[model samples]
Target: MDPKTLLQNFINGLSLGSLYALIAIGYTMVYGILRLINFAHGDIFMMAVYFALFFVTLAQLPWYLAAILAVACAALLGFTVDRIAYKPIRNAPRISALITAIGVSFFLESLAVVVFSGIPRSFRTIFPQSLNEMIIIGGEMEVKYGREVIVGGIRFPVISLITLIVAAIALVFLWWFIFKTKVGMAMRAVSLDIQTTSLMGVNVDRVIGMTFALGSALAGIGGILWAIRYPQVWPYMGFIPGMKAFVAAVFGGIGSVPGAVLGGLILGITEVMMVGIMPGAAGYRDAFAFFILIIVLSIKPSGLLGRPEIVKV
Candidate 1:
């Protein structure tokens, strides 16, 4: 491959990887706190994209406003799902909760089909036409010019810049909340021992709800960004990304925030590189990701950054 082509592919990989990381963080955060798989999360992310699309088409709203509304709708939907489906089974057996999650996932998908219909919807270009122009970089490589710059000939996409900025801001706030704030302390305490935290006068139910909301909101942002990049929307659009994000969470160690981000970037870049290196590899892209998942699990079941769980009998 030419140096310019290689540089462009790497930039694409980073942009794709960042989106995966954002969605994966949602999975990791929910699992970290509640140990629930949240099968409905992918659909929730999908719904956010649809929500933004609806606003853009029907209300004729600008991209920024549509995105904000989509995030709000996603957070609300996630909160409602927790209240209606998961909350009642909080104290039930683990199997029961898992079953409930599956049911909820199916219900959400079904509702989407009924409401949005099974047909695919394409999104209008969110960015202005002027922003779509290409610029020559390093006097040889051509890169898209927009609101962001390719750093020192690195050829990073403008969208990647936005994703990194949003992810960084979210991570910094989350770190502060988890380590510095009173609610953060309460959340950690509940994660450690819900019963004990309740006994200590913490509102366990509220904390769990907030956790779900926060995670879902992140997924919402990821979903809208995804729509912007791909510009396609369908009822089942979330399936692959959702599963991959879950794998990323597992690969990085389920409960670790940094781990999820790292895992996402690794998975995204590896998949992109596999296609670039092998001409026929694109056909097996989905399988390749799963194969990597299996290998990772076999070598390190707790995940690359996961802490080993200790059991006492």
Candidate 2:
């Protein structure tokens, strides 16, 4: 492939991977602390897009303001989900929590369909026209120049480049929060030993709730970016991406934040490359993610960065 095409493909992969990583971080965070899958995470993502769409179109709010509100609301929704769905199952068997997660996921999806209708909302109405314009080179390949960075003849979309930069910043902040801050220390303590941490004066419940909030906020940001890139939002939009993010989490290492990022980037790049190289298999793009997941699981069940579970006698 030519350098330009290859570069474009790489950028495409990076953008997709960044979104996956953002959502996957949420999965890994909650699972790390609570040992729950929180299947509704994807639905939370879906809701975020709808929330932004509503505020932007119906409320006539600026995109930046709507995005902030959407993210805040998503965080609150996540906190509530934990309290209503997962909290009650804290002492129950893990299976019960897993089942409840699935139920919650369905409830969110249904609620979205009922409220937002089944129509896919167009993002162009809200997104600035300048950002929507494309730069087509010789009618061969079309790409958005909304956010372009041309460095020594390698061009990248501003959106994809910003997505990568933003994902990296978020990851750094999350790492600092996990390792440096008081709440982060509490979170780590709880993840290591909830019972003991509670005994040590940490409010285990609060820490877990914060984990949900943080994770959901990332999902919300991811949802906004996804809507921008795809230029549409639908009730069922989160399903495939959410599943792929989960695969990324598992691929990178379920309980490790960095692992989630790594997995997402890898998954995103591979998917783009696969479709690029084999246009005939474009329909099977989603399958490639799952195939990677299966291969990763078969080769290293603990994930690329995850530590194996230790059982006590």
Candidate 3:
């Protein structure tokens, strides 16, 4: 392949990977705290995209403002979901919680369909027209202007830059919150042993709610980013990304923040490379992710970053 095409593909992969990482963080966070899958996460992501679109088109809001509103709405939805569906079953059997997650997932999907109708909606393009501008790189190659030149003329997308900046800020803030603050300690305590933490006077419920809110907020940001990159929206849009993000969470070690990011990048790069190397398999691009999920499960059931559970005799 030509250098230009190869460079462009790499930039695309990174942008795609960043979205996966954002969504995967949500999965990892929830799993870390509650050990529940929260199958509704993807649907929540879809809702955020729709919410942004609705605000922009119906409410006549600016795109940036709409995006913020969507993120806030998604956070509220996630919080409400926890309170209404999962809170009552907080002390139930593990199977009960799992079933509730599935039920909540289906309910949210149904609600989306009913409210938005089954038809897919295309979102307004958010990329600038100048996004396609190009600059001469090597004597034989040209690099797109949207791609940043950090050191040589090697090109990368502006979106990739934004993704990296936001992700880094989020990680820094998350690390601080989890390791430096009193509330962070309480959260860690609750995750280690909820009953013990409760006995120690920690508000387990509030911490869990905060965890969900944090995860959902990440998903909301990811949803908006996905819309910007793909320029399409639908009620079912979150299903694939959500599932893939879950796979990424498992691949990286479900409870590990850094693991989730690593897994997402791996998945994103693998899928992109698959397309690049096997042009004939372009139609199955989506299946590549699931195939990786299966292989990871078969080879390392505990996941790349997941800690194996200890059972008492």
User: How close is every model to the real structure, measured as TM-score?
Assistant: 0.90, 0.92, 0.88
Candidate 3 lDDT by residue in tens digits, 1-313: 7777677677667667778988998888777778888999999999998898899889988767888889899898988999999999998887999999899888888988899998988887444456555544556555556435433556565666666676667668878988999887887787688889899888888988888887898899889888876778877889999999988888888888888988998888778877987899999988888898899878987678777771111
> Which prediction has more favorable lDDT, 1 or 2?
2
Q: Which candidate is the best by TM-score?
A: 2
Between prediction 1 and prediction 2, the one with superior TM-score is: 2
Model 2 off-target regions past 4 Å? 125-127, 133-155, 310-313
Q: On a 0 to 1 TM-score scale, where does candidate 2 land against the true structure?
A: 0.92
The true-versus-predicted C-alpha distance at residue 11 of model 3, in Å, is 2.9
Per-residue CA lDDT of model 1 for 134-177, tens digit only, reads 54456556666664455545556667666667767776877897
Q: Candidate 1 clashing pairs?
A: none
Candidates in order have lDDT scores of 0.81, 0.87, 0.81
* RMSD over all Cα atoms, model 2: 3.4
lDDT of 2 by residue, 1-313 (tens): 7878888998889889999999999999888887888899999999998889889888989877998899999999999999998888899988899999999999999998899888987874345656655544444554544546555567677688768877888888888998999999998899889999999999999999999999999999998888888888888899999999999999999988889999999999999988888889999999889998899988998798997881111
Give the Cα-based TM-score of candidate 3 against the true structure.
0.88
> What lDDT is obtained when candidate 2 is compared to the true structure?
0.87
Model 3 pairs whose backbones collide: 147-156, 253-305, 253-306
